[model samples]
Target: MLLIAGLQWIVGPLIEYASPSLHYKYYMYVEQTQYMGFVVPAFGIFVLFVLVLIKKTALFNFQLGRLENYSNYGLVIFIIGVFFDVFGGFLPGALGFVGFILSNFKFVGAIILYYSQSKKLKKIFYVAILYLLITSISKALFHDFILWSVFFYMFWSLKNKPSIPVILTTIIAGALLALTLQTVKSAFRAEVWNDYSGNKIELFIGLMIDSVLASDTDVSQIDGDGVDSNVRLNQGWIISATLDHIPSNQNYFNGATIKDAIFASILPRFLNPNKTKAGGQENFRKFTGLELSQGTSMGISIVGEAYGNFAHVGGILFMGIWGFFLGKVWLFLYNQIRKNILIIAFIPLIFLQVIKAETELVVVLNHLVKSLIVVFLFIWFAKKYLKWDFNK
Candidate 1:
């Protein structure tokens, strides 16, 4: 599970953040600072802390009962809520409000029905079909399906059973991968694999070292205005240029240089900076091109980020530690929340959103706190209603 999560996290960033152009021009320019190395380790440490807290709370105690009776209605409702949130965000005016209400109601209803043995699978199937229909028509289902597949796989793996359906699913996944690769190739008008020169392994290691070294620098000297100006200037230029012409995907080794530059030149000015008036939508419009929707972050990018900062061996070690600690934490949470419908529903929803969006800082943190509260509420309910002993 930890390996899977780590892989997921690494891939998205690599594809989106460390593509060839960014790597060569930005990453390479500041490679000496080893800025990424520091960030990755700090993230690992934070994950470690979460794991310890779960252990201390005695959260890991669970049993998977029969699937038929163990249905989670709350979870279904939460999933619906997410779908509504996405759909509503895309639509305009009153229609959006209708979508939001319908989705939220479906989600809330699903949760209420979870603990009851009232035709659960039928309801789930109907909701799934409705969701698929909406997603298909809107062309948003593909991303959601990809993200949900991971969660479904994890859930099924935990169940310790497999049949013909699993085999067919694997085959389908392979077909999808092939199709996606072909589509990306056609859209970009370039061979995807040809750009990856054999030097990625070495370059990734260099970037990791640079990231770590650069992270050590003190950032208290620079002012907030300077950082905002830098973000605007750099982000504006990149987005504007990419919109004008399709750049050659020649250099896949520039992420490290960019990381180094950010640490040395930009990090100092953003220590306690105020929020900048930047609009992502404006930037997105300016940078609109034949870019793949999935972006550049995937698989090897995570490994590359680690390698870019701490070098090959250090990257492996860092990821390994992160994986182990995260695995432990997740195990604990699963045990605690497995039978608690409310917590299970809310917690997984938040976690899914974080994983899907690659949310950072305040956003993810706020969700985490909300999830923790749900978990505690479940604990209190279990103690008062079911007579479960926390001290046991």
Candidate 2:
């Protein structure tokens, strides 16, 4: 999965570059800011390393029988999640209705399911590609329910454990590495290393390479406020906003103002739906006090809101905490599901926000916590009803 993810990250720029004519308009809107260009690649590498480490860690080494049992429970949870998504999308006020059901029921139910039993690499890749294509096309075609169903299908695919082929894995890793290099080359061509340009990409990569590297003060001078006339609202701008808001000076739990914190918690949910509001540009400027135009800037502004609310430490803490809790839910589900069949159902739900450009820490955390409670409750019920014991 890490290899695939890395390749995807790398492939993104290549896809954009190879079809530059097609992607030019999109590229103009994306900032690919030096700081974020650096941070994203670094973060991806860090995540990959962590995943590898976890796989090697003895703590996760459950016996084969135990692992199979966990997979069984996860299957059940996946089924329940599918039903919730379906009914929530079709029924009137379904989100609210689902919320009520969840509150009353006190179980997370199944999310999307995964098909971990598959052993063929070709089959898995084809399935993944097909899933992405269908979801993407469906989202483009049908605006609501069909799109939601796409997520259910996506998550189901993600959870499935397939025996990835060595050749495919190599291809994915090589592709990702190539993409990262291309991104770096593009950054250089754009003269990102220059002093006035912030040189954030160079600095971030440098830091990742050598943790003790010190960045020049000029890097900080890049105007974070959207008021700078020279700053074009693009992908770079969005990346800058996310990076700028990291609260490096204080602890995540202790270091934010009431207003900043409030905005951090609420903005992601507000902008989750991609539809533009009337006079949205003016409204955004007024709300954020940043002179951003619509397009990806709006999405990046959401990241800015998070940073403005909590800073760097806060952002990491928020994501880390989210990852931890979500990880736990995943572990519990893995323990309970019947077949490895339901793993893929949750992937879409997990990655839905990937392209959104905002990282609303508070909203994500709140939703995740609620989800954990429900999942735990569901597990409890399953265990009791099935008369299963944890200690084998």
Candidate 3:
């Protein structure tokens, strides 16, 4: 998944500069600031090392098979989430936000619940893919589809099959998608989304296919938004950009961003109306000298903001902590799944946000907390009314 995120900025420079017709945005950054190129890959290698080392620390070890008594709670939760994905799209503002978060959790829950039951799991997975695909089309953003793929990978990981066919196929498909992602996003930006309301399910399916194969011959100008758009949604550029932009411009954040994220996690914006929008969006203009246009964002990476606030060493430390957090949470999630599948759904829901390297710390953390709260509230209702009593 991290590899998928890094593809554009990683290989994009080479393809663009080598080809006469291609003009990747990162080309300039690569040509001028060559050293920054190593930051993300090196950081990734470091993270892998940290994770591997942490395993040798003799902390978490488990010998377990599939759950003997699988609960139907995952199915119920998944169904409710589907309701949100379909009807909740019509809801607006906070209501809509709540709807999607609540409804969107099936992907996480599906992992454990459906793993031992592949026949049912595949059905739910398809429904989920359909839901995410249509949503991605409507928004002209491909992150939803990207997310589904992650869930899909996790689903497959449970089996740990004998053959490596799935792995090989995914690699090929991912490479194809990475190569053509920009073109499809460009097409959607210019052509697919304008009369979007009238488009059919088949149309969306076709266009999504076109996105991977470069089936649409029309040239597109990607202006860098969302997953499929003209920008690299997740990449090392944010880290490099912060390294280059800050101190060079002498506009350091001075720990303000981290403070904002912590605060934002506690105080909901709706409750505190005048609250300064914490997160990296506010820093976008300051760092990049580019205003976030409507339907577009200069997505700030969390580690980037970490770097922006505390410089390189601090950012590396932040990644170590981040990796540790994920490792612990994942272990906790598996443990909780062993205990109760329903309520602890928050385990996977929160943990999966690790893949979302595009958002700032505040945005990601705030979203996680809110989602956890939502899940908690839902569990409360379930215990009181449904009498599940899923406390662990």
Q: Using TM-score as the measure, which candidate wins? A: 3
Tell me each candidate's RMSD, in Å, in order.
Answer: 16.4, 14.8, 4.9
Winner of 1 and 3 under lDDT: 3
Write out the backbone clash pairs for model 3.
81-103, 224-231
Candidate 3, residue 370: Cα displacement in angstroms equals 2.8
Put down candidate 3 lDDT per residue, 1-392, tens digits, no spaces: 34533553444334433442333333233242443444454457546744674464345432212421333666777777767867887876646557868777677556445544557654665666666777776677776687666656654554565357877887788756755655556556555556655565555456556554443333232322323332343354454555667768756787887787777677766775654454345777665544566645555666667677776676666766666665665555556555655433355466445556566677677767777678768877887899765442
Tens digit of per-residue lDDT, candidate 1, span 1-392: 23334433333234334443343222222221232343345346545655664564454434333333434434544565677766767766424424534354343334334334567543653465356435532332244445444544444455546677986887587555533322322212222234644443343333334433433232211211112212211221232223122223222223442243234222222352432111122122222222323343211123333333344355556545544544565665666555553344344444643452222222332334444554466458657986654331
Error of 2 at 180 (Å): 18
Q: For residue 272, give model 2's deviation from the true position in Å.
A: 18
Please give each candidate's TM-score.
0.43, 0.42, 0.75
- Order of candidate numbers by TM-score, starting with the best: 3, 1, 2
Better of 1 and 2 by TM-score: 1
Q: Quick one: ranking by lDDT, best first? A: 3, 1, 2
For residue 224, model 2's alpha carbon misses the true position, in angstroms, by 31
Which lDDT tens digits does candidate 2 get at residues 1-392?
23333333334434433444332123422344544454354444446444543453335422333333333454445345445544655555314433533432201122311223423422433443344334433232212223344444333333443345844674476445333332233233334324334544444355333322324342223222212111221333334433433333322223233233345334443454432222235223433334654343343323243344455445444434433444555555455443332322333343333323232333333344434454456546766898645443
lDDT of each: 0.39, 0.37, 0.57
